[model samples]
Target: MNRIDVHHHVIPPFYRDALAGAGITAAGGRALPDWTAEAALEMMDLLRTATAIMSVSTPGTSFLNDTSAAVELAQRLNDFTAELRAVHGDRFGYFATLPMPDATAAAREAARVLDNGTADGVVLLANSNSEYLGTGGQGELWRALDERGAVAFVHPAELPAPEVEGVPPFAADFLLDTTRAAYLLVRNGIVRQYPDIKFILSHAGGFVPYASHRMAIAIAADTGRSILDILDDFRSFYFDTALSSSLAALPSLLAFAEPSHILFGSDWPFAPVVANQYFANGLDTGVDAANLAAINHTNAQVLFPRLAGAPITTSAERPVVRLRHTTQRAVARALFKLVQPGTN
Candidate 1:
């Protein structure tokens, strides 16, 4: 029953203020939810997530022209999450955000955060400019992560292009970004060079499950090596059971990945239908309960050994505190009002 979530989102006060003059339809416009520390803890209870490792959800300062501002906000967000870990006394952990689109600034933040032992890992967007994750010299960021065999949770973000009228930001654009980033790593050899870093792919490895056949053929045509042969790079990589844990995806994932390489992800308020979606579709009964604990918390201990461990147990060793919203956290309800982006 030791459950932990490796993928969750938080809106820092900095980015919230930056969106003021920006119209709802700016480049790959993002919607704001009434996200607050209190509401997040409550959602944790409903989702049965004992501890959530939060990260910089999309718009990780990739759009901002001011690189310094991006760096400042990134540090502040890290500080805030670390404070949450401090306040909640180990119910949460976080991935550090870096100001992408600027290699030097990003390198500085990653080095500082990880070296200080503040972050569990880093959450990198698929692209910061027109360049994808492995392109634009972004490999340096991964190299820094590699030095420590750290976790790299690759979450999808909207492409910085004008919207294609019918396609909502949440549609194909996000999926495409995830695919492009993963493909870029393979092509650019970043995944090959930095084999030490553990990369966690979001949204059930994006569309890679369905598209791998075509990609495999393309690679076979060029390199004479099967794409699945190359997928071994991802052997060290991890997959989070986010919204894609539903029927359409779980089967493919089961067929593709060993369960130990799989982890839990809620995608939280944005993908609220996740848990029920899996429930309605049914989960793979073969999944290991102990491994489920690993997906939830144990493996994270492997990732961040310094992070707080198992919750306090009762006389029967049962987790008496489970996921209830403590009275102290409920006081945060004053600010956690629901808003747009349609509830998750």
Candidate 2:
């Protein structure tokens, strides 16, 4: 299967040096892994991944205290990735980094890279300096992305809360962080408001498919909106199966997500090659051939039409067997009771 990995990460030399200079040698409670273009290509070849959409992972530009420094680092990282793509155009694409929480600077950077074809899209951390994506004062950034009809990859950052002793943020907290951002986007109407910008949620939307109906109820109660309408908005976000392609998670994700919204991801280098292979194997065994083909590449072609260099087969061309709605709701209800028993 030729897959398009939307969740691959890039670690530029300057980024590593900057982190080292700041006495920050770890990200998401893990030591940074060495990376190179050759290695990434080799991994892709091993996994049969035809293309990788690269982005800088967590703590993106947020580690820099100065707005100018953050902006500059984002530009440098983006430029470096663009150069890589220029050389290996068929094998790689990149999502530009933006210095968020500094909304104005982020907006300017988004325009500079996206307008000039320097990026396939942009990557935004779930939160920057404790300011989440759907929060206020980010109208400029949203508008800029919306105007371009850009694809924004929503990656998780370290949680704002204090870490549990001996627990890594990426293990569990990252999921919650992405879920929080997705909820806020739907709650605050950013998903609906910025209709043009396609938001790709990493790590299988980080518990979103499992908890969506429950969240929809909460949003409906707070906003006086229909739960079905809120759920529809939640479903609008794209989901990439990165570290989340296990057999246990696939059913809920495949059931809740729109057919074309599920995309393949490897979370490579950050996820380690062994882990990537493990999950990729799980996905291979969990879904039928046709559905697997869609998650691997066909659906991705619809989003990134430029990747349609050869004859493209879409998911609509095959028969997909999805989990019944009754089963999905039963699972959701069980999970809801376990998580929040007293809720209506």
Candidate 3:
């Protein structure tokens, strides 16, 4: 199946200089990954990936407190991606980075990127330094995304100070931040307010599958409020499998959300190198084929029609029906039946 990976990233040299100039390093103290487009494409080629929509890495835009520097950095990253996309064509598209603390500038940057057609849409931190981003000053930016039917890749940013056990910062805290943003967007009426923009959450929708009951309870406790109202709005959001291809996580997602909304992502060029192995190996997994390919590539194309180049096809394109989940024996039988010359 041809796949259009919507959650891949590219950290250009200018961003490295910016981070180093500010003495900033690491993500939650983990070393910052050294990202390059060349290595990214190599990984994609190896994975049979057709195209990847690139976003700037974390601590970007967020680290630059100076709005001007943030603007300059964003422009540089956007331009760099434009050049990459130009060279690679649709195989490499980009989501724009914005200067967020200053919402006005953020809105301006969104316009600059989208209006110029330099990017497909915008990529924003889910939580801007500890607070949930709702339909507030950020609304100006959302409005632009909504107006253009743009793709908004909402990656969870640095979580609040508290870190829970049994799950490290990246696995637990980052995932928790993602759930928090999902809630803010759906239950808190942000997604309801801005329905036009497509929202893509990272790491398999974070803690949503585990914590969805809590969300239901939150709705029930507020009995006066409509129950399960947010579920519909949430269907609008997408999730990527990054650091979330675990036995515990992936199964719950299959149980909870449909595979059509789960996309594949590999945060590459991880500084230590061993990390990238973990990311790539997760793909040759045991998830059901229809759903797995959808997660890997098909769903992304459905969401962003512009990514039509992905080689995979979905039930959406054909009259074929798919089973939600099935046993390995059944899949093997189906595979055998399809390969037989006289099966028809």
Candidate 4:
């Protein structure tokens, strides 16, 4: 369909080069994909995506570990992204990344970026160097975003844990990372206090949907609040269908998430073309017409009014281009099972 991708990644030349210079080659256990404006357009055309909201993926300039360096890099990356949006306002938009872990610097940059209209929204990693968002330290940043009614895209990053043998962090740890951030935000009353800020959780909220009741029950017991109240907080955040539009995951996401809260996300570049296509195919096949239309087009237009929209397109109306990699699909299913942290 005419999709608005809310979870696409952009690796600008300077950002990519900076990562290389730091001897950091991978993000969340996946090799960084080669990206260019031309390449991104080509993929969007293939996927029938009309507008892709870009964000810097994991291991952002936060790896610099120096406040001054992180601040400088955040500005550079945000400025470059803003330039792209300025030039390609129709085809592209961006979520500005903050120099996080340093909440003060992050809050300052957030104000500057959002005030100048340099970004459509801001992208925050679930945790920056083990200091998760939504905690007391980040109250200032949350307040800044809340005051502006800002859209915050909570993307996953590598956690502070050692790697598991034969398991990719993107598949498993990233899920827990997003879940932890979501739990913290809800548990600590950040969502309630900062009600104006809309937080979009990546990877269908990373097991939060399926395990939400467990979280609610635990928190209710701990806080002596009603389970429904905790559940309400858990459901307050938005979810993107990046790497999660499947029979297994989408069902829970659709069931648990408010219908209007689910947004389309390709996780492109990081999620290779084949993988993106696989999930797109699942979304096409699994959802009904109206829901598909909402997820792909209408919901995004509501979230980002400035982004232009086109007529809804569906695989049913067009020639079906079937996914070619059956073997890869099988492998993906197996990996998905391995990475479901809440299951065990």
Q: For candidate 2, lDDT tens digit of each residue in 43-148? A: 8877777789999998888988999999889999999999998988768899999988899999999999988987999999999989999989999999999999
For model 2, which pairs clash?
Answer: none
Best by TM-score: 4
| Candidate 3 per-residue lDDT over residues 113-224, each given as its tens digit | 7888778878888777565667356677777778888778887777767655545466467777788888777766777777878888887788887677678678556644
Candidate 4's TM-score reads 0.91
Consecutive 10-residue window with the lowest summed lDDT within model 4 = 312-321
- Count of steric clashes across candidates, in order: 2, 0, 2, 1
How would you encode candidate 4's per-residue C-alpha lDDT over 1-344 as one tens digit per residue? 67899999999888888999999888988778799987887788788887889999988767987999999999999999899888876678899889998888988999999999768889999988888876778888988999998999999998878989888899799999999999989888999999999999999999899999999988888889889988999888999999999879999998899999999999988887767877888888888999999998788888787764444433223443445556556756655554454553
Which pairs, if any, clash in model 4? 1-313
- Give all candidate RMSDs, comma-separated: 6.6, 8.3, 9.3, 4.5
TM-score of each: 0.82, 0.90, 0.83, 0.91
Quote model 2's TM-score: 0.90
Error of 1 at 326 (Å): 32
Clashing pairs in 3: 2-311, 2-312
Query: Any idea what lDDT model 2 has?
Result: 0.88
In terms of lDDT, which candidate is strongest?
2
User: What overall lDDT, based on C-alpha atoms, would model 4 receive against the true structure?
Assistant: 0.86
The best-first sequence of candidates by lDDT reads 2, 4, 3, 1
Model 1 reaches what TM-score against the true structure?
0.82
Stretches of candidate 4 above 4 Å error? Answer: 308-344
